[model samples]
Target: MVEQFQNHITPDSQWSTYEANVQSYRGLSMSAQSLYLAVGAILLGLGDKVPFFTVFVLAMVTTWYVFFPVIFARTAVVDFHKFNFGERFSKDGALRTAREDSKLSERAYANVLGGRRLRANVASNIDMPPGQNFRTMRQTRLKLDVFIPASMTVVWCIFAVYFAVFK
Candidate 1:
């Protein structure tokens, strides 16, 4: 049993490690957006003097084409997942109209009937061991909201200084 548990720690699973990495990457990607925007804005502010017309155009294109869809799609997917199927598919709802019903996994049905578990399953997959505690893990996790914006502010200030000095 000890060896079996040890194997779970290695990066070999189909879901757990992959999902954990995916979640981490998502957090990092979201955090990078503000920093990218700040850099773009600073570059735009100094574009003419720096003779960086290409960077200016690229930034403009990214702002319109790339930024909106990324943010919107991410928000929509998260919100859609949070919708309750039972409420959304009741007597007055979509499933009733369709004349077909969806089935839930036995475990999932049990979870719903029994009550939703308060603590999230952070293990990403069942093969791996469950984590310590959500509150502790959450507190320790890199909070992108606070630090990402703070770091972006410092970066923007530094870039503004450079733009002024080099101009």
Candidate 2:
């Protein structure tokens, strides 16, 4: 049965569709980051009303600590989405570019997953850059580490707590 299925399947050259969850989570993170920046600004403006120093400090801290990383991280992911995976694999320069981009993508995923500890897995493991070793589908975005949204969420939560409890 498996042999028959394999024989029936045609190999087509097309970019595989990304899961909706992948895009959605990235969108959500971006939105949350924007909101935090906006609201934190407003709160800071109103800081004169109560415990002036505490309020101002908390607002600034929340803006810097919480909103900043989310904005940068999510923005990078947005940049990730902008990348043409197909271009990366093209005969022109996609292979070279993709290999280099893969290292960045790998680092982003690593930071989002097991933290810096996963550096060896994503960064060092991908050091060859295709000239020395062929690029694989698993290296592109198939790995389980692709979802760094979870890590961003954790950072977001910690910042939110600081805002709620102290601000």
Candidate 3:
């Protein structure tokens, strides 16, 4: 499989398919980070008027909104750091980057450009598996499912608590 990947990735044309994901990394990461962090801050701010439980519930809901996209963004970063550039994503599935030492099955890779072969480029140039979009309308739309309830959970918890107790 590794050999197959090397063969597939050797072509420069396939590399073009991944150009958007690779080039757009900054915007995608920034957008997701901004959306969740900003919304998280807003959720936290609304906490004061609501009950402690409500705040806690909001925090939990906030976790969902803040969590998955972060996982996606962070994974993209880590995945890219170990990015084989045109190769399929890491088979290991962890954030592990390419080895600096020529030890994986006695195979070693080093940057001819970076002087001192001991220093490796590691996992920073991973490409999105072909036919996949790192950032897309569908993925963005899915946020509605999370934010809808994640946001509503906060509102519902607030109103429920208010009418049940604060009323």
Candidate 4:
């Protein structure tokens, strides 16, 4: 397991990590939206049965607090890397990515899920301990991930309440 990501943690890894994170975050956000829509459909369809409004309100709360933050955090991290190190991406990136992947088995330890687990896996892949960029990536990824979800929760909760109470 450690051996798999041994090359993704060095200062040189910033670009690869950022690219991986950007791609992962996009998919995660879409998944969050899909989950929200699917669950909302099921709950709304219930209508008068099982106190559906209450169920929706609760589900929205969870999505706000739990689901969306996960996606947001990932986005913030990639955005930071892109903002500060935009040049890193432009120079020989595609070729580098191809070269990096050609090695295989020593890149990153990814799974069906992406986030903290993946960060740790990437860290473990590096030769030395993480530097400023790596640590910042993980910290922001952890901190902001939940913050965005909070706003989404509030907005959705308002929508749910409007329909349940006013509509």
Candidate 5:
């Protein structure tokens, strides 16, 4: 199976696809954040001209209804790629010997391992449940992706309530 896979797709191509998925995840996440900010600004600017309830509903719908689903999907894709690459490239995987035989210098190999460790560190969160050992890069990204929009949504709701009660 490994030979068949290698025959059909080189490690380079698989890595490239993984990198592309990571880039797409980042682009989508940033675009969503920008959209939230833009929508909030536009609605807030309309202040007295538009009903506060309308602004609140629009903000809630845009973040939760429109963006959350897409974010979830993108996160899943990136996670899949990350896991696939790890499984294929890990020490026990078929590609491990192939990668080890490559002409990378000792320093370069060390750097590569260091980079992997750094990515792992970045993925791990203190908030994670106890006894959960492995941490993937996607987990960290998923937290940020959901947390930012959730925070924005909460702020919008607070503003809406304040306006409804006092303004």
Candidate 6:
């Protein structure tokens, strides 16, 4: 069992998979935003030819259809990476090696583990909250992933209502 676990710790093994997922997450996120903008521009260019309600429905549908799947996929990738990293880090020898090699500081290790089960060395000075101090990378990406599509959908809905009632 120990040998099997050690085999996965090599640079080309689990780390590579984590790196690939990070790349995929980035690509999917960028593609979602780009496609959203492109579709919005195309729909907006139609001007008065398209009915407001139709435009709104199309925009909402397109945003949700394109983005929600990407969001789901990214979430899955994140969850997998998180689980994999946590499992690897939990090994006694691995943790000791990481500390001795200065590969990861205590705070960084805690943050990557989502601030859970923090060691004494980490828990003292980094007193923000669980998942709060860990917001270095994921915070902005998650915000953009979820909010942009939702806000755009709301904008379309508002435009549709304004045209229906006022115009």
Among these predictions, the greatest TM-score belongs to 5
Between candidates 3 and 6, the one scoring higher on TM-score is: 6
Give per-residue CA lDDT, model 1, range 136-157, as digits (tens): 1233233432354345445545
Query: Which order, best to worst by TM-score?
Result: 5, 6, 4, 1, 2, 3
Question: After TM-score superposition, what is the CA distance of residue 67 in candidate 5 from its true location, in Å?
Answer: 1.6
Each prediction's TM-score against the native?
Answer: 0.31, 0.30, 0.28, 0.37, 0.47, 0.43
User: Would you give me the overall lDDT of model 4?
Assistant: 0.48
Q: Per-model C-alpha lDDT, please?
A: 0.38, 0.40, 0.40, 0.48, 0.50, 0.48
Model 4 stretches with alpha carbons more than 4 Å out: 1-10, 48-64, 67-155
Clashes per candidate, residues 3 or more apart or on different chains: 0, 1, 7, 4, 0, 0
Model 5 clash count equals 0
**Candidates in order: C-alpha RMSD to true structure:** 13.1, 12.7, 13.4, 10.8, 11.0, 9.0
Clashes of 4: 4
Error of 5 at 46 (Å): 6.5
Model 3 lDDT per residue over 83-152, tens place: 4422332333223346532222112222122212222222332245877644321354356434543564
Q: For model 3, what is the C-alpha lDDT against the true structure? A: 0.40
lDDT of 6 by residue, 66-159 (tens): 5455444444434434444344344221333344533322233433334334432332333466666533236665666567666766666665
Which pairs clash in model 5? none
- lDDT (0-100) at residue 7 of candidate 2? 29
Clashing pairs in 4: 5-125, 6-125, 69-145, 73-145
Locate the minimum summed-lDDT window of 10 residues in model 3.
102-111
Expressed as tens digits, the lDDT of each residue in 18-136 for candidate 2 is 23444554465456556655654555456533443344445445545654454444433332334432223222222345244433332243133333333233323333656563222
